[model samples]
Target: MPINCKKQTLPTIEKEQIDLLARLSNASGVSGDEAEVRKIIREEITPFADSVETDVMGNLIAQKNAKGKCALHVLIAAHMDEVGFMLVDKDSEGIYRFSLIGGIDERSLAGKQVLIGKDHLPGVIGACPVHLSTKEERECILKLESLRIDAGPGCTDLQLGSYAVFATRFQAFGPSLIGKALDNRLGVATLIELLKHCPEHIHLTAAFTVQEEIGARGAAAVAYNHKPDLAFILDSTPAMDQPSYDNAENTQYRTRLGFGPAIYAMDSNTLYDHRMVEFLKTTATENGIPYQIRQPGGGGTDAGAVHLSQDGIPTATISVPGRYAHTAVMIARKSDWENTLRLLTASLDSVSQDIFKNER
Candidate 1:
């Protein structure tokens, strides 16, 4: 029986989903240091998976076989790591000098609270006193050169080279969900839901990857190892959906809130598999689920690595629109995430060998 939207009821995300998202948002999974988040994922998914394995690169690979003879092997991925800082040095006064683990706006550095090291010790990025800064300093955006994390006076428990991340906890306000690490944690949460309800036609392989912010390192390895018939890189893409300065027209919003999922035709790293793109759009339209085409240009996701794993695996990215990615906190709509999961689930349920028979 092929999976279709007519007989199947779309899963509604509510408190349980939000609660898992809260746990993921609060966990620390900085690039090259993903232990905390990995632990939580293992606990949540072990029961649902037919087999679970971990690799040297620290990606958690879980498998679920189809109920009958599988027509295709489907690989779905969501990155576990988030952008943060690594302490490079500790000053005599216990101030920590750190380097960013991934792309970040230096402007968000000053006066932000951070949790440093595996112990999750509290710290703050200190700024020069407002009364002391000259006008020239005030006029320009602060750079990484002018920042230091003050763990507090005489605190020496944290070692050099430890990871640091924003101390922001998860919160849901009205129509918006806000938290740190939402960039891919939202993806993480979405993948978890999909795992629980594996479709019957295709054998499902889930990749909970690490080091994505650093360069899609884990994704490349997982794709090579599994080599699915096709792959879907599930992630959170930056919406940048805010209004222009002075309320002027903002034409370049990569995505916008309430637009549902953003399906990638092309991103900086890869041109998505054309047939897969059409399949996703067709499924969404048939189900009356809303979706958007991600503007093609800058930024990328795990698809950058997965699509080129071998001779080449057909890959597409389906992302939830998020605002303020790579910063301390990000916001996204639960409604958008709902449609993302629904649309992807429908497509995967309906997938067949025929989709790949079309042109590249």
Candidate 2:
């Protein structure tokens, strides 16, 4: 029998894309401590980008030259940091307790694994075993105070000020890609893909922001400095597909996994520019790119800061719909990622005057 091997042409967006995204997502770069993620972005994005620089706040700004040199600037933003905890105190016995750097749903963090410090020490957030807990305890709301990261040999290897971050674990289940830090790492990955394919005529500044989970600090600084005429924020939005007590308006928010990217209209802090929103939708539809309208919105992106900066830039957001956001198991669909790349590339390639003029 002849040994047979088939020649396989990999996908246009190959496993390398997902693998790179996963590596960046898994790397610990909590809010203000983004050196590692920034290094990765600098290395991969610098070659394709025209000019790159770091602002006072450590936000990474990458630019590509465009044919139209009319000083009309377009800025696109995607936050690079994720919600995690900082070391609050360490007990003499080596038990480490921390406070959240951003909004972390305590319920989801009960038994998750985490990383600590520059070396990324492996640790697990401890929880009472089901067998050890009483019926009443099981029904009670879990508190962050009860959580302790098990770093082992607490007195020797662990210190009082060591930070902890969710372990980066990307898993594919059915239609979803579940992992930690997808909230903003997905945005960074989308920007990288955009840079790889961005045409020469699209003159824009891309800012991979920092400290967005705590407050939109990085976005505010970069937007004020650049004063872009138009800005687009790429991010991950919540996927409300699970069964819950609130079902009446819940169906309106069914941004499902694998559906496509989301055209975010409004959130708690920002209302998008109407023309920018319409343009993104129309362009995506005409280009046959998959997309969905985000119904019953609830989260904020860098669009909030970018729209309010300088003389006020017209802004809108496009996000990958994700399940279990702000948790160790945030899940996003590959189709959503692909659609975001398509919509962003199309939007940038054919940016119009009307897109920047819309104030609403």
Q: Per-model C-alpha lDDT, please?
A: 0.90, 0.80
- Model 2 collision count: 1
lDDT of 2 by residue, 110-130 (tens): 777788888888877878889
| lDDT by residue for model 1 (27-51), tens | 9999999999989898999998998
> In model 1, what is the error at residue 23, expressed in angstroms?
0.4
Per candidate, the number of residue pairs that clash is 0, 1
**Per-model TM-score versus the true fold:** 0.97, 0.91
Can you tell me which runs of candidate 2 are displaced by over 4 Å? 1-12, 129-132, 243-250, 356-360
Predicted candidate 1: what Cα RMSD to the true structure?
Answer: 1.5
Residue range with the least summed lDDT across 10 consecutive positions in model 1 = 1-10
